[model samples]
Target: MQSVTLSLFRFGPLRARLWALSQMATARFALRAIPDIGTVKLCGSGVGEGFTPVPDTSVYAILATWPDHNAGRRAMFGTRVFRRYAEMADETLTIFLTPASARGRWDGQTPFTPQDITLDGPVAALTRATVRLRSAGRFWKQEPAISRAIGKDPNVLFKVGIGELPLVRQATFSIWPDTQTMAAFARADGPHADAIREVREGKLFREDLYARFRVDAVEGTWGGVMPDLTRRPTSMTNQMKVAAE
Candidate 1:
């Protein structure tokens, strides 16, 4: 079976670099039009007004499903559609993952199918939620501090926030070297734990879905330049408002 890939792009923060979601509709349309494309989504980040206070207008992302590895690679690395996004941003990062377990629905259907993996490697996680209007404030209240904690945690390989709607619908995608490390960051003492508790107690979201996957590859660049994916970005300080829309 062909593996799935999730390509991310974070552009440089320049006033001239700002581009709204509406303007990119054509690009999103073009990608879906690709014959091999499966489940594809375009999202905005919440580093600004939506959730996290600190943000960058330049950052945006792409999540895609393909028929196979070759199909994904052909579109992302070779197609004109992908090139336009890369050229517009000052920085961009993309990673590919193989699903290990997926449950629940996304837009009514499960977009990712779990696949058996017989290898030892890194792990990736995705959390999606539809926030209830009444609880939106409380949910966002915990984001800034938690985001900072994740950004500072050495165990985290990389993570990003992306969503269909600013605060009402949100999702996070993160990678960890191992499950132990991932749990360490999400455990009792941290901001993550606090947020988890509030959600359970307060019923913050009307719906949610989470999944784990096996790492396939972490490649590509950000800001017109490629950086080492094995380690944190050299300019990590600027990414403080790292959550998505």
Candidate 2:
């Protein structure tokens, strides 16, 4: 019954954006005070579909874990920090998820507890890594190609690059219609696959975690468009294709 929430906030106007940036430090205090909230991370996005050095000042994300779906919803909709964020954002999207599979660790601690349930519909993939300082240059060089590959993929329902720290600590969250499609992108002969090979062969990440989740629900809109998880292979594909075009 454990659940996770990934909330994306888009701020408009210089003041709101500045406030969002400040929350990167200040929100942690508020989040820590929440009773049922477990592991929480406030992340900043990178430019143009993420995986870059330049920061996107307008967008930020909150990733939190809770005891159950109800607890997660309460924390998101009822907590002071989340309420303040909702009041200021131009548009926001929150995805409710149940971990289906997980491995490795974040900040040396496991964040998600996977359930013994089958994931048959839309699945989300999250990968977080702390890049080695010496491997930073090589890691960054592959980012553009990797971003371009994922950007061109029609099977990807949603994707964004976010990180706890600039440059060194990086993470990606993506949604696909099913696990097969998600795995296809990773297994394909492309920049992503190449990067995976290098990461394993060269020890690029100092710490890393990869997790898959069942998409329980999606709320609100991202970039003025609400992601409809109800529509499966057909409509979703068409919608994404149109967005890409």
Candidate 3:
């Protein structure tokens, strides 16, 4: 089973923050050498509303794919690269997912392999794009409104704006109770909808990807507490295990 893991690390002290920042470039080497690892990205989050020109600097993410659940778990919990980030961060959270549907590419490579099974409960959506140089200004101009809209969106169970590069390359990951609620937000009349139209007409991105996933399980804490998983099925709930801190 193809699995994807998004590991978030939140740093507290200046030293830890700096180390996290430096690893955005330095850690890739270690990640590439890891066994069973597939596509990987070292991402930084946007400041405040979470879609901005400025980065938060304190929060970072490692998005990786694995051959199966066991391999993903081993890498996240056992590898030196992951353990180092965990040790340095004040808080950490990792979510495991199985792709339900996916299209497009990231950095010219398709990262997720979709499963044929239907998803019934909590769903997660990941969208990534590399803004064309000429379209950067136009792309970012929509950010304030889109960020505000998403921040105020009540249907979103969880959301974060993270990217490999600030400004030019960005991605947003959000969880919803179901696919219907998630699609409503995307189709609704708003800044996000407006931006979607503009992107299509303008051909704003050099590369882009959109994927929907079934939330297999999640471990650890985000913002100092675990995300409520009561909405997920008992089968997935049974799979949840808090990773050693």
TM-score winner: 3
Candidate 3 lDDT over residue span 10-88, tens digit each: 9999999999988987999999999999999999998745457788888999999998777888787789999999999
Which 10-residue span in candidate 2 carries the lowest summed lDDT?
A: 236-245
- Model 2 per-residue lDDT tens digits across residues 67-149: 87677777776778999999999999988888999999999999999999898888999999999999999999888999999
TM-score for each prediction? 0.81, 0.92, 0.94
Off by over 4 Å in 1: 12-16, 48-55, 223-245
Which lDDT values do the candidates have, in the order given?
0.69, 0.87, 0.87
lDDT accuracy of residue 34 in candidate 1: 81
Q: How accurate is candidate 2 locally (lDDT)?
A: 0.87
| Winner by lDDT | 2
lDDT of 1 by residue, 1-245 (tens): 64677766666555424554444566677887887888887777766322453344666778888765656766765677788777766666767667887776777778887887742556788888888998877777777887777778777766777777776877888878877777677784977888888888998888877888776655666545553343334333223222110
Clashing residue pairs in candidate 3 are: none
